[model samples]
Target: MSGGVDSSVAAFLLAQQDYDLSAVFMRNWDTGDESGTDKGCEWEKDWEDVQRVCKKLDLPCQMIDLSQEYWNRVFEPSLKQWESGVTPNTDVWCNREIKFGALLERLPAPTTSNKKPWIATGHYARKSWSTTPNSPHTRPRPKLLRPSDRGKDQTYYLSSISEEGLSRALFPIGHLQKSEVRELARKHQLHTAERPDSVGICFVGEKAKFSNFLSSYIPPNPGPVVDQVSGKTLMQHAGLWTFTLGENARIPGMKERMFVSSKDQLSNTIYVVPGSDHEDLYSNTLRVSDFTWIWNDAIPPDLSTPQGFRVDLMHRYRMHSVPSTVRKAETGDLIVTADEPEKAVTPGQIAALYDGDWCLGCGVIKSTSR
Candidate 1:
C-alpha cells in the first residue's frame, strides 16, 4: 500500500464494504539506511505509517521483503537498458512482476472454495467487468478503464500486466478524485491524511536527485556530445546515460540553449540540437517490440491495408495523446504512425494505445523515424 493516503483510503473503503481483507506492505528496496535517522529516508517512516493505519483499522498487516526480487527483476534490467542508452520503464515491470505477480501469489488462500481472494491497491485506474466473453475459456472480460481522476490515472504503469493478474486486482479508490481521497482519509482519521506524496524512484531517498542516485550504480563513462545536424563535436559528456531526450543541454560557452536530440550507444556519444523544435527531435513513425494487447489477444492490423485500426497513442505518463494507426510490419514488429509527428519519442520507453476510456495495449518503442 506504500503507506500513502490513497492506499490508506483504499483499505478503508474496502473495509467499509465489510469484506474480509488483509493489508500487505511490500519492502521492495532496503534503502541502505541502517541508522534509520535520515529524515528524507522513506522506508522506516513509510513502514510506521502502514502499521499505524493497519492498527487503526484493526486489520492484520504483514511486511513482505521483496528487495532481492526487485533488484533481480526490475532494477537489473533497467540498468542494462540505461547502459545501452535506452530509457526503460522500470515501474511497469515492478507492477507486473512484484505487485501483481509475487504479492498476489503470497496472499492467504481463500476461506471458501468459491470465494477467490483479490489484491487491492492504491493505483488510480478502474476496471470494467463484462460477463459476456469473446470465447469459451474467457468467460468474464476485465477491461482496464481510465480512473475518474485523469491526472492521477496509473494505467500506463500497468499496461504490461497480464489478463489473469488483472482479473484478481482491485483499486477501491479509483472512482474518487485525489482531493476526495484526502477528504475521506481525514474523515476516517487516518495517519496519512496530511502526508506529502512520495516522489521520484521508490529506492531513491526523497532528498536525493535522480541523476545523483543513478550515478552510484552506473560509473561515469566520458564521451563526446555531437550536434546531429552538423555532425560536429559540440562538447564532452560525463556519461550517455546521464541525459534524456528533450531535456536541456547546458553547454558552457554556447549562448543558444540546446536539447538532447538522440544518442549513439555503440560510440558512447550523445547528440544534441539547437532548440526544442529541431527536426531531429520529432518522429512521424516508430517501431515497437514486446507488444501486449490487454483487451483482445488478436493479431495486429496489417500494414499493407489502408491505415486501419485507429487508436490514441501515449508515449509517457500524463502526456497528451495523439491520434495514430497501428500496423504489423513484415519483420513481426508493430509500427505506429502518428497523425502528427511526436517529439522525443525515446527508444526503450513504453508506447501505449487507447480507445476512448479503455487502454487497448502497449509496446516497447524500438526505434523512431525522425
Candidate 2:
C-alpha cells in the first residue's frame, strides 16, 4: 500500500470479503529526509498511515527494503535508455520488476501444508477470469481490462506483465470509482479517507524531483542544442536525459517555444524545431521490435495475412490508444500504420497491442517514418 486512500480502502474492502491478507509497504529510497521536516516530504507519515490501516484491519504488516534491487533493475536501465535519447517507462519497469517480481520472490513458497499466496494492489484495472481452466497445472490466466472507472484505469502501465503474473495478481479497487473508494474509506474510518493522492514517482515522496533523483546516479553531461531548420547552434543543456520529445527546453536567445524533435547521442547534439501542431511532427507508421505477446504464441496470423485486422495501439501511459492496422514486416518486425498520424512517436516507448479490452502483447518502438 502506497499509504494512499485508494490502497487503504483496497485493503479494507478485501478484508470485508473475508480473504486472509497481509500488508507490505515497500521501502524504495533512503536519501530523503527521514524526519518528515521538509516542506513536501512525508515518507514517515505515509508509513504511519499504512501501519494504522493494517492494525485496524488486524492484518500482519511488514516493510520490505528493495532499494538495491530497484536501483539495479529499474532505475539504472531507465537511465541508460534516456542517455541514448529514448524515453523509457520507468514506472512500468518498476511495477514489473520490483512490485510484482521481487515481492513474489521474497514470499515463502507454497507447499501442500501451506496456502498459496496472492498479491493485491490498488491499481485501477479489472481482472477477468475465463470460464474454464486453460492448463493442467494452473487455472486460466486473468485477462487485464479497463476498470469500471474509465478515468482511473491503469492497464496501460501494466501491459508488460506476463501471463503468469496476471494469474496471481488482484486489483481490489478495480471496479470502484475514486469517489466510491473515498466513501468506503470514510465508512471504515480510515485516516487516509480524504488524503490527496500521491504524485510523481510511487516510492519517492512529494519533495523529490525527477532531475534531482536521477542526477545522483547519472553524471550530467552538458551538450549543445541545434536548430533542425536553421542548422545553427542554440544553447547548452544540462544533459540529454533532462529532456524529452515535445518538451520546450530552455534556450538562450530563441524566444518562441521550441520542441525537441530528435537527439543524436553519437554527436552529442540535440535537434530542435519550432513548436506547432503541424503535421511534420507526426508520423503515420512506426516499426516495433523485441515483441512479446501476452495472449498468443506469436503475433496473430491475421496481423500478417493479406486480410489485415485493425487493433488498438498504445505508445505511452495515459495516452489514448490510436486505431491502427498492424502488419508483420518482411524482417519480422511489426509495422503499425495509424489511422491518423501520431505525434512524437519516440524510440524506446513500448507499443502495446490490444483487441477490444484485452491486451494481446507489446513491443519496443524501434523507429518511425513520415
Candidate 3:
C-alpha cells in the first residue's frame, strides 16, 4: 500500500467489487536512515499500519523481499546515468521494475478454470478498453491515459510500460480525485486516511536527502565550472552528478544566478550560462533510441507513412506535452521535431509519444539538435 490513503482506498474498492485480493507489501530498502533518523528504517511502522488495515478488511497480507532486485535493477542503472552527468528519475524505474515487474513475478499463477489474477495499484490514470468488433480476446488491452482528475494524473510516469503489462494492470483509484480518495478512506475507516503521503522512494521514506542517498554510491568528484559567456573557468563544484539541467549551481565568483546548460564528463567540466534562457540550452529536435511500443502492432501505419505524422510529446513527468512531428531517422531512431523550441530536453529521459490521451510508446532521449 506504500502506507498511503490512495492505495488503501484502492484495496477497499477492490474488495467492494468482490474481486479476490491480496495485499503485498514490497520491502525495497533495508539501509536505515529512511525515517531521517539514525535508528534504522521505520518501514516496520508502515508495515504494521498495512497489517492493521488488512486485518480490518479480513484480507491476507504478505511481505515480498525485493530489496536486492531494486538495488540491482533500478538504483544501479540510475547511478550510472548520474555518473554520466544525466539526471535520472529513480521513481520511473522503481515503478517499472519494483512495483510492476517484481509484483508480476510474485503473483501466483492462475488455474485453467479461472482467468489469471490481475495486479492492481492506486495510480491515478485512466485505463482505456477497446470496443472494436472482432477483437482477439474477450478482454481488450487496457490503455494508459490521463485520469479524470488531471491535477493528479500519473500516466506520464507509466508511459514506458509495454502493452502486455497494461493488459494485466488495474488502477482502482483512477477515477477519483485526491479529495474523493481521502473521503472514501475515511468512510471505510482506513487508518491511512489521515496518514501523510510518503515522498521520494517508498522504502527510503520521507525526509531522506537525495544527496545523501546518492553520495553513498557515487563518490564526489569536484570539477571545474566554466562560464558560457566569458569562456573562462569560474570555479569548482562538488561533482557534476550533484547538478542537473536548469539547475542554478553556486560557484565562488558568480555575480549573477547561473544555470547549468551542459556537462562534459570526459573533461570533468560543467558549462554554465547567465539565465535559464540561453539558446544552447534549448532544442527544436531530439533523437530517441531503444523505442518501446505500448500497442501490440508495429509503429502505427500513419507514423510510418512517407508524410510521417505529428503528435504531442512529453519529455518528463508533470510537464505539458509539446506538439511534435515524428519521423524515423536513418539509423531507425525516432526523430522528434518540436513545433516550438523546447528547453532542457535532457538525454536519458524518456520521450513519450501520445495521440491525445492515448500513449503510443516511449524511448530514451539520446541527443538533441538546435
Candidate 4:
C-alpha cells in the first residue's frame, strides 16, 4: 500500500467487492543501516500509515523485507549507471523488477475453486483485454492504456511490465482523479485522507541532498570539467555523478550561465555549453539496446519491412511522447529517429514507445546523436 492516500482509497474501493482482499507492504529500504548522519527514508511512519488504513478497512496486512531484492534488481545497476554519468530511471525498474517481478513470485498459490487472484495497485494506469480474433494467442492479450486522467497518466513507468504482470494487475484508481481519490477517502473517513502525496525517488525521497545519499555508497573520483565550445579546461569536479545533462553547471567565475552538454567517461571529463538551448544539448536520433515489445509475438509487421513503423517516443516519465520512427539495426539494436530534436535525451534512460495512448514497451537508450 505504501501508506499513501491513493492505495488506501484503492483498497477501500476493492473492499466493496466480494473477492477476498488483503494488503502486502514491501519494505525495500533499511534506512538505519546506512552510514549517513541523516537517516534515509522514514519507512516506519509509512508502515504505520498502512497499518492504520488497513485496520479501518479490516483488511489483513503483512510487511515483507525486499531490501536485498531492491539492491540486486534495481539499486546496484542504477548505481553503476550513475557512476558512469548516465541518468537511469530506477523508479521505472522498481515497477518492472520489484513490484511486478519479485512481488508477483511471492504471492501465495490459490486454494479454492476460484483461483488466479489478481494483484491490485494504486498506479494511475488502465488495462484492457484484446477481444479481436487476431489477438497474439488464443487467449486474450492485456493492453496497458493511459488512465482517464491524462495529467496523472503513469503508463510510462509501467511500459516495461511483462504480459503476465499486466494481465494479473488491477488498478482501481486509474479511472479516478487525484482529487477524487482524496475526496473518496474523506467521504469514507479513512485515516490517510489528509496525508500528503509522496515526492521524489522511492526510498531516497527523504534525503535532503541526493549527492550526499549517493556519496555514502560510491567513492569520489575527481574529474576535469571542460567547456564544449572552446577546448579549455574549466576546473576540477568532485565527481561526474554530481551533475545531470541539461542541468545548470555552476562553475565559478564564468561570465555567462552554463549547462551540461555531455560527459566523456573515457577521459573522465564533464563538458558544459554556454546556454541551455545550445545545439550540442539536443538530439534527433537515439540508439536503444534490446528493445522489448510487450506483445512480442504480435510486433507490428511493418517494423520489419522496408519502411520503419512510426511510434511516439518518450524517454522521461513526465514528458510528452514525440513522433518517431523505429527500425531494427543490423547489429540488433533499435534506432529511433525523432521528428523533432529532443533535449536531455540522456543515456541509461529507458525510451518508451506508444501507439496513441497505449504504451508499446521500452528499451535502454544506448547513445544519442544530434
CA lDDT of every candidate: 0.84, 0.79, 0.80, 0.87
Candidate 4 lDDT over 1-370, as tens digits, reads 9889989999999999986788989988766567453243578888899999999999999998888899999999999988988888888899999999898888775676556667899999999888544344777789999898878888999989998889999999999898999999999999888998778776667535787878888899999999989979998887888888898888889998889999999888999999889999999999999778888777776776668999999988778789999988888888999999999889989999999988889999999997
Candidate 2 residues 1-370, lDDT tens each? 8799988988998888866678988876654434444445455677888999999999888888787888888877888987777878877777778887887778765454475578889999888976323334354456788888878768877888777777788999998999999999898799899999777776454533776666666788888898888888888877787777767766667767778887888887888888765454688798998777765443466777875668998887777888998998899898988898888888888898788887767788988887
Which 10-residue span in candidate 3 carries the lowest summed lDDT? 31-40
Q: Which scores better on TM-score, 3 or 4?
A: 4
The TM-score between candidate 1 and the true structure equals 0.93
- Candidates in order, TM-scores: namely 0.93, 0.89, 0.90, 0.95
Cα miss at 16, model 4 (Å)? 1.1
Candidate 2 structure lDDT = 0.79
Which pairs clash (backbone N, Cα, C closer than 3 Å) in model 4?
none
The collision pairs in model 2 are none
Weakest lDDT window of 10 consecutive positions for candidate 2: 131-140
Error in Å for residue 132 of model 1: 7.0
Q: List per-candidate RMSD values in Å.
A: 2.4, 3.3, 3.0, 2.0
Assess the local accuracy of residue 229 in candidate 3 as a C-alpha lDDT between 0 and 100.
Answer: 82
lDDT (tens digit, per residue) of candidate 3 on 1-370: 7667887888899888867678988888765423455354666777888898889988888888788888899988888988888777677677778777877787776654466668888888878787334244565666688887877878878887767678888898988898999998888899899887667666444533766667777888988888978988888877778777777776656678788888888988999898778887898898988878776454666565666788899898778889889988779888889999988888888888888988877888888888
Q: Compose the digit string of candidate 1's lDDT tens values, residues 194-295.
A: 998877677774534777777878888889999887888988988877889888888878768889998998899999999779888899798999888875
